[model samples]
Target: MVQQMVQGSVDKMKAELVAYIDKKFEIAALTSDSSGASNTEETEDSDPITLSMIMLQIAAIFEKFGHYDEIYRTYGIEADAFQDECNEVLDLMRYQVEQVESQLKDFQNRLHIEESGGESAVRHNAEMQEKFEILSKDVQESISQFDQYIDTQLKQFEDMPQLLERLQQELASKQGKSESLVRLQEHKSEMIAKIKAAVEELNLQLPKVVSAQIEKALKD
Candidate 1:
């Protein structure tokens, strides 16, 4: 195994890799199922880029590492871990999606009973206002975290491509990790697509869900 290492070193490179993974945590796969070009432009806080872009960025990260198994032991990055990360993000989207769906359902249920300008409607509007304000705040925080994630990925994939290439090139000569890299890329894509559809629904509903701003639009 030592003979397989490049001429200059093994221990130093291993240490460097260990340090890098420690610092990076992992280039996690943030999953989302299929979405139909959801309008992400409505929110000032949401990233302009599509969620699909964010989910697919894992491909760029996989290209950085040479030994897939070694990286897994050294860092908790593998197909299963990547899927778990994807599911975790999906959970967040599901939460907001469910919330909006419930709110909309309740709004419909009360539509005929409550007079358009009556006290019951006013109270229901106030109730929805409060619920959505809380939901909006939580979603904003999630969006911020995702934006940070995107920035993190952008930095990692772009930061040191040359050095990364040198490492992969040298290591691939003996390890033939190119095949492993391809498998990981396919795994990421499969898992990440599962959550995009829910996120798209959430994105489509959120603005209209929160259209009433307590006083300004509540009168209607």
Candidate 2:
């Protein structure tokens, strides 16, 4: 675009320069110092003025052309070098713009992927939070039930130990007077074994329940 604008200005300057040259030629041909009376005065003043005008026109043409660099190198004065420099710079700029546009397009595609990934992450986080909340509630409920069962079983086991102690004491105190003491001692031992079995059952179940809770927590 800059090249085109520079070319257009050069063409316009060329046209104007041609017109100025024609006008100068015509004026010189018509109004000359031919009679010798005005000749000295015209030579002294008019020729210089015409030369100055031509020089000014040439300078203006160079300025319009905008090739200052080459003009300085070739003629030691700025001339039509402006157009050539502008064309070179503009071509380079066009290539840079194309590269930038391609990079911008690639960035846009990456931005879309990042946005989509962000959205997916949001959804996944929400789902995980929901699952965590549900699992936490279930775990809490299960733990409460387990605690209640443990409390009840503990109370029962405590009572059994006290009963065993009392029965042992009774059998020892009535050892000689009561023949039934032996049978009572045997019954007490059986009762103790049954209590131990019940305690073992609860111990085995408690660990399983805790492990299940841990697995559930992991899933969530």
Candidate 3:
């Protein structure tokens, strides 16, 4: 009965933890999509002011990624601790089961001794045997359930690091792209300013060349 209760509590905790992790992944996906959309919309035709805004947005996205990364790291640590706890529980339960089996064997040995004694001893021994069988079945079921839970938890633990690593890679790629976009925008602005200055210089020299050409034509 105690083992059943403990299993129930562990199952509940597992459900809650899985739900929380799923929600975190969902939020991260949504945030990434939103960031991508914002970048797409901003990168089309950015002026200096717009570029500044993009830079700010990129900074904010980086900050958010950093926060998410920390959360992931914290989650990993918590998961490791939780795994350790589950392992300890499993080990304890296994020990208890072994002890129970030893007690069952001793009881059976006593029952065999009592079998040669009398009818009353035989009746008590039969009752005890039934109770022991029920107890053993319950213990077996609990161990089976525990094994399943451990398998599920192990799979989750195995997948988690991969998921975190993928997210980190994606964020890094986005950051690089954002930085490249900023550099390209800056280069574009510089080119525009240089072209404007060159045009102004040509405009300033055009009249002088035209007036000199007219005077030369008149002399001819």
Q: Which candidate is the best by lDDT?
A: 2
lDDT by residue (tens digit), candidate 2, 40-154: 6655655533778878888888765757434445653333576678889999999999999999999999999989799888999998999888878877877887888888777
lDDT against the true structure, each candidate: 0.55, 0.74, 0.62
Q: Which ten residues in a row have the lowest lDDT in candidate 3?
A: 42-51
- Name the regions of candidate 3 deviating beyond 4 angstroms: 1-68, 119-220
Q: Kindly list the per-residue Cα lDDT of model 1 for residues 1-220, writing each as its tens digit.
A: 3223422244555565565544333322111222334333223224334446544544443443345435545554455687798999999999999999999999987875565558877888899998778766766665665566556544643534574565456556655577757755564565455346545655665454444333333353
Q: What TM-score against the true fold does each predicted structure earn?
A: 0.24, 0.36, 0.25
Which stretches in model 1 have alpha-carbon errors above 4 Å? 1-113, 164-220
Residues 86-133, candidate 3: write the lDDT tens digits.
Answer: 999999999999999999999999988877687987788898888667
Which candidate, 1 or 2, has the higher TM-score?
Answer: 2
Model 1, position 48, has a per-residue lDDT of: 38
- Candidate 2 or 3, higher lDDT? 2
Off by over 4 Å in 2: 1-115, 177-188, 203-220
Model 2 alpha-carbon miss at residue 96, Å: 32
